[model samples]
Target: MKRRTAREKALQALFQIDISSTEPSAAIEHVLEGERSDDYLSKLVNGVIEHLDEIDQLIKAHLEKWSLERLATVDRNLLRIAVFELKYEHDEVPEKVVLDEAIEIAKLYGDDQSSKFINGVLSKVKQHLF
Candidate 1:
């Protein structure tokens, strides 16, 4: 699968796991819809779940007056995946790429203001990280 498709599927799996407390592997399978899973997809979901606490703390740090749990699910998980990639996969993924991907995905799956909100918080997180 393309990286974009992989990111989208990873977000869906993370969403499922967030809402239902489903196992990360099962959530990945559910999103795969029986298609063969890609390495990037598994890497994204597993990486995000494995480091959720640290990711959430990063998000909460960058948020302005908004807590992580209060954010919309799509927005929350989108930020989580982006933050994970930014922090853990920085050697492989560029910061601009992670920020841009999260913004675009937020535009598609998040509320109207989600892209703007995500951009702001992630920019801060990026500044702090890099």
Candidate 2:
């Protein structure tokens, strides 16, 4: 699957896992809906889950007034995916590409302010990390 599709599927799976406490495998399967699974999609979901605490901490640190839990589910998980790519997958994908993708995904899946909000926080994160 394309990386964009992988990110979108990863976001859906993460949203499911967050809202329902669903198992990771179950969430991934649910999102796939019989389509062939993509390696990047699995890597994203599993990577975020594996590094959740650290990811949350990075997000929490960058947040202005918002707590991690207070952010919209879509925004929170989108940030996680972007941050995972930014921090861990830096060699594979450029940091700017990660940021741009997250903002675009937010525009699609998030509320009116989400893209801006994600862009702002992730800018800080990119600065801090790099």
- Per-candidate RMSD vs. true structure? 0.6, 0.5
Tens-digit lDDT string for candidate 1 (1-130): 9888999999999999989999998999999998997999999999998898999999998889998889999999999999999999999999999999999999999988999999999999999998
Model 2 pairs whose backbones collide: none
lDDT of 2 by residue, 55-102 (tens): 999999999988998889999999999999998999999998999999
Worst 10-residue lDDT window, candidate 1: 61-70
* C-alpha root-mean-square deviation, candidate 1: 0.6
**Candidate 1's C-alpha lDDT?**
0.93
State every prediction's TM-score relative to the real structure: 0.98, 0.99
